[model samples]
Target: MTDAQEPRRARELGIVVGSLPTGPHNALTDVPGVRVGHTTVADPPRLHTGVTAIVPDALGPGRRSLPCGLFVGNGFGKLVGATQLAELGAIETPVLLTATLSAFRAADALVTHVLAGPGHEATRTLNPVVGETNDGLLSDVRARPVTEAHVFAALDGATGGPVAEGCVGAGTGTTALGFKGGIGTASRLVEGWTVGVLVQSNFSGTLTVRGVPIPADDAAPVPEGNSCMIVLATDAPLDARQLGRVARRAVFAMARVGSDFAGGSGDYALAFGVPGGAGDTPPPDDAALDPVFRATMDAVEEALLNSLFTATTTVGHRGTAVAVPHERVLRRLREAGAIPR
Candidate 1:
């Protein structure tokens, strides 16, 4: 598997996904205490998959659980530890993303890492929230090259700032909207609170960016059995129910980019927040949440575009998903007046 060649994000091409201004890094890591890490596996003949770790809030020592929620757009896919997450409405471990078949192993490895962290001596139960998308179209799903070490490596290597996207980590061999799909992330500041999103895009649908339709390419092959995993983070002090509301909006963003939400596709979104604790400012009421919702929809949509734009052509055993040509998309957006000349 050749490395993603000449990756570039949408904004680099003068294309903005929405009207809202982006956070400093325009990434999920823009959320306070959020960190991301990736390990791309490209071991020839087979194995073009890896792990991506997102620690919502630095979890170690005596850190408290972060409020979290889950919204299922489709239930035809595998997501480890969904029930417990929905039941508890909080998470104490880092969120992990990996290929479909590798999810359980990744979850186990995550549990191990959390158990071994600085503050878990007598902790009996630990829930590892893991998400996945089918990448077998490009990689040998049977091999399951991802190991516990890879999980730990991703967890231990987490860092803040700009996140590495496109054909990297769990997105190594994913396909989306008739193009090579991979890890993508973006963030937006709404009213003062920041909402950030990261996506592992491997679903099927027509591609559209900023109201401009991206014509299908004959050279690219469509993938079978769809799925997409979205992770959203914010510093807003939101509870599980509120997070679920925003999570649904993220699916709208996905639809805006062209996902059909087919029966076979398991579309899942997990949202978490680390609100200012104690005497810190309280989160806004529901009446004041409209701006946050809008920002979420915008960030998610832009993040999907960023996924396509930053990824390069991927050639695999099953088929090849040529990267979407940025010049062509830029032209369409220019024609549609989505991008100013």
Candidate 2:
């Protein structure tokens, strides 16, 4: 495929987000022990949805729940198990993402997966975290095409390293910022610690790239979309409380990418930290969080951009959602001096 005909990440086009150096994969899996997998369900003119799973290291033998935090940028989502995560400040199972109507099933599958894993034979109580974005505009939401098997496939196939992005998994039928949106990921190394972010971009607003706005005609008719889901992982040896604060920064980064956080947008960010990370000796002071916060924001912004850049056009039940016109966007950025001509 030609350049315009193919999909690529923001970094591939020289649209780096911040000054921090990225990990080897420049993705959420760069945090180590974090794996991602997707199960795309594309059945032509009617179905275009799937499942994305984020599995932390605490899911196998000697499995131990990890410290986690949930930050809600907007309260318009049907996020299952949020109350428990908020009250308990941790996650017992792998986090899953899927279409709006399929969130419940995905959560159920997650619970089943955890209960069936080694060491959880007799466990009764479990909280399965699942987040979703409405894909009704592009798919038959009422049909609920995503099934337990699909969720299981995602969970079972997850692996660490580079993750697939855009027009896949839960983002298959999603749109954002007036363009086709999907899965995106990015990571940053802060003082030898890794902070990684993965986003399901479906929320809308003005389409901006490095502070330059694409002309409205090519940026869709209006800033219209419903939700976005952000998943952040880090190996900083932080607890749930600190992760919550860092997660707030991740949500704030949505604004940097032009998210309006509209009334209908269900914007949520879930952050988790591995136990035996660098700084396990003595937790760093809150005063030293400035760099971590900055890194989180920057990674989120780039992840959102990657969601748009790597997505290709799609035609579904509702209508056609075109991918961002990368060449045109780059032209705008160049003229505005965001990139060299």
Candidate 3:
């Protein structure tokens, strides 16, 4: 899309999220060897769901898995392969995200893709990580329209660099904080390590930015059970234990964007670290990890804003979800001195 036609990110609108500086793309792809792709099915009033794939290119060669961690803030939804990933603290397949009912199909497709990789002929077992959020508000979710082809397309088409956000992929049919919600990503550089976060937002609460609540005059009553899925990638050489700590920060960062963490919000976060090209670098001292944890929270907070800021109004099977009014938000931020006038 052209510059005028392209959706704008939060930073572009003068809503700077944190003190940290973002990477070149301000996206998950900033981490070396990490790629993101989306397959959106926008059939309008009937269907608006699709699949998103996050491929950690470092998983090939002599390495078959990356140190990974998962955190579940609420467990009200289905997440395929979560138990295995948490138990092993490693991920062998590219992570996939899709609508609620289609999670199983996406997981199956992810397994097929991994097994098809070179040197997997003898592999008898594999765990495919897949996450989901309810998108029935904007799609015919019961139809489970996501097919293997869609999942494969996202995986094979994954690439590095800029990522598409808002109303795409698994976020196509999602809503958040009284506004349209979709895929969003942000990256931070801390202690020479790149920390990137990607989020699929679909929860509800008062919208807040930089401690300022942006009232939603058009706020509509949304369903009770919704969720947000987060994925964090870094080249920090952190072990699964450390990554788990970082993942916890990501889940808590949701509150910065005003998530209620309600009884039915299936808030989840998965963090994985890819080793350096030379080899696995020794993790920094635990005391030095404070910066990494702070950066993770900052990146997660910005990512959640991006999901709301870039999303456009969407009319789906259930009803209409209006996009957050940028001007109104800016005015509120200015009044609160959160951003320069």
Candidate 4:
């Protein structure tokens, strides 16, 4: 189906949440030129996992590349290829997300994928951005199920539209705040510009949605150790440092909704600004960077909200099921006067 048809399908499946209107596809890919794809591994009793790819756009001499930044909230997790991206302030290849134990494999596969692409020149080095969250709860992580093919599949199927959330892609085996949480995304428009956020939800602790705290009431709460990987994309023009600042702002949004960045939680945020063909770099001086900062924070905050609002409850592994009751949540919001009558 065409990208235009994805949102219609999402709405038909009741995959969308919240009252706010979404961008064309209600996803990070909704940003012009952004593309996404996934490889789901559903070998029951063995592996339940996958990989996701986010291709920003073609990179070349005349093409304007996305300006990106990274922020490490607690810094306990591995984010491959960040060092170079942070230092050079550019990313030439697509970004990939996958299961925790598969970071190395994913990175290697990404390198191969980039090399195989057209116009990719001979280079002794390649920076492949790969992020992850633990998914052992529902998958055999040690088995190393995410192969190069999975990574390639994600890259090959990239498209701009409403992306699959919950039990799909990298979120296939993820959990959050003791609930079944996986992939979630949200976006917002500021001054006619769009900003989107996507997350791999596996962090531990109580989760709050729109100020509604969801404590773990089940016999087995998610362990104290877990992590979350967040990606923010926007049409706003921002430099690397500015992007990092924006990524930091996402932490506040997470905290606003009750994530404490516990000892084991690998809370990190990556932000990228969509570049306008030419002469789009921000001014060199610090003072001139204020506008970019504001835009980043706004995008980060809204993107996080989108992540929570887009996710739904899921069931997995040994009959374990957790669901976020949409009606109940909306009713509670109305009763508390959080939403207009």
Which prediction has the highest lDDT against the true structure?
3
lDDT of 1: 0.85
Each prediction's Cα lDDT score?
0.85, 0.87, 0.89, 0.68
TM-score of 1: 0.95
> Per-residue lDDT tens digits of candidate 2, residues 83-194?
9999988888889999998999898888888888888878879888999999887888889888889999999899998899999999999988888899999999998899
Clashing pairs in 1: none
Residue-wise lDDT of candidate 1 within 236-261, one digit each (tens)? 77777888888888887888998888
Q: Model 1: number of clashes? A: 0
Q: Candidate 2 at 163: error in angstroms?
A: 0.7
Name the regions of candidate 1 deviating beyond 4 angstroms.
1-5, 277-282
lDDT-better candidate, 2 vs 4: 2
TM-score of each: 0.95, 0.96, 0.96, 0.84
lDDT score of model 4? 0.68
Model 2 clash pairs are none
Better of 1 and 2 by lDDT: 2
Candidate 1, residue 327: the lDDT equals 76
Q: Please write out the lDDT profile of model 3 over residues 15-109, one tens digit for every residue.
A: 78778889999999999999999999888889989999999987874788899989999998888889988998999889999999999989988
Cα deviation at 281, candidate 1, in Å, is 5.0
Error of 4 at 328 (Å): 3.1
